[model samples]
Structure formats: structure tokens, C-alpha cells
Target: MTTWNLNGMKHHLFFCNGGSCTKKGAEEVVEAMRDEIKLQEADVRIHTTRTRCQGRCEDACVITVYPEGVWYKEVTPEIGRRIVREHLVGGSPVEEHISYTYEDELAARPDTKEGQSKTKRKEAQTK
Candidate 1:
């Protein structure tokens, strides 16, 4: 058997195939992505992985790509193919499908006491 280093891969893709996502056609998305990758002969550059719940039940059939750390929501088979062709091959992210990014998470965090107070005030106002 030949050992491969995961770090060497250019893109690592994870498809959430858990119960919620599967109900949303996660299996079909996975199949489409695999087919596209094989068609493009990108197996050497991209690695695909299956994962359980990503905790975004509302965004079922989520696809996350790294090391860019972009999370795409509500992925259909067609969207999967586009992601492979446009994002993986063309080196561009499918902005329409992107639900969130690592930068979004960072920006949402309240780093200072003043920021935390402001966030709490906003939440209270919404309620």
C-alpha cells in the first residue's frame, strides 16, 4: 500500500451525509461531485471526505471546502457539479451557494467587553 500525505492535497472537501443532509439529497450531491471530479481528473489535487452532522440542520446537504474554509449550504447535484468545475478546477468559490466562511465566524465573535454588551443589546432588541 502506498501512503499519502493529506496535507499535500490542494483542496479537501467534506460532504455532510448524516440523516438530515441525506434527506436533502446529500447522497446525490456526493455522487455528482465524485463524477465531476473524476471527469476533470482532479483526484490528485482534491480529496473528498464523508462526514456526519455539521450542526447546520437548516442548511442540510452542506458542502465545506478547505483550506479556504468555505461552507456551502443546500447543495443539489447540479450545484455539486458546478462546485467541482468552477471552484475546484477554476480556483474560484461558488458565491451563491456559500452559507458562511471562516471570516464570518471570526467577525461574529465579540472580542471585547464593549462588543459583547452591544451584541447583547442587539439581541434584546430583536426579542
Candidate 2:
């Protein structure tokens, strides 16, 4: 097995650049985030990643901040900057834009039977 090291990084920001997210301006968000991080001078501490898909297309332009496992959805360029400045630089997550936590993502695994059952139940209730 290959060992991967984080080089003492405190946080990892993953910006989804998949099909849906791309259409929603994921690239612009990435640029804005990078600019904000640079302006805040936190480039050495936080790592940024561009990923293909996070399996949350409905919430396209999704951004996941790891180590804390915070997931923000429908992120625009402005929100991306806030994520860098507020969450990464200030050490406080911007709670208003958060769609779910890492725990919520795990529990909503649509591929699993339990998850599917829950989804169906929720749909039924709505109908």
C-alpha cells in the first residue's frame, strides 16, 4: 500500500468539478476560493482539491471541508470566498450555507438498502 501524507495540513477543501457542478460555475468558485485563501495567507495550512463528483448532483457546486467534515451546497463564487476567509482563515465554519455534515452524507448513502428505504419512506410521506 502507498502511504499518503498530509504534510501537517490542518484542513482540506474539496470542490466538486463534475458535470453538474461545472455547469453551475465550479471553476469560478475554485478561483474565488484560491484568491481568498491567498489574500488571507493561509495557503500553507489549507489544501484545496478539485474532484470529479461527490455524488450530490442535486446540490451541485458542492464544497466539502475535511478534518471538520463540513459540506456546503449550492456554493457561488461569493460563498466560496467566505468559506476560505470565514472557515479556513478565521477557524469558524459558515453555518448558513452548510447543507449537511459528513455524518449526514454517510447516513444518506442511496446505494444501501436502508438508505433507499428511508428515501422511499420520505417520498411517501411527502406524497
Give the per-residue lDDT of model 2 (tens digit) for 39-72: 8877778888889999989888899998878778
lDDT of each: 0.81, 0.81
Which residues of candidate 1, in runs, are more than 4 Å off? 1-8, 108-127
Evaluate model 2: give its TM-score.
0.75
Give per-residue CA lDDT, model 1, range 5-36, as digits (tens): 66557898999988999999999999999899
- State the lDDT at 114 in candidate 2: 44
Give RMSD to native, each candidate. 7.4, 7.3
- C-alpha TM-score for every candidate: 0.77, 0.75
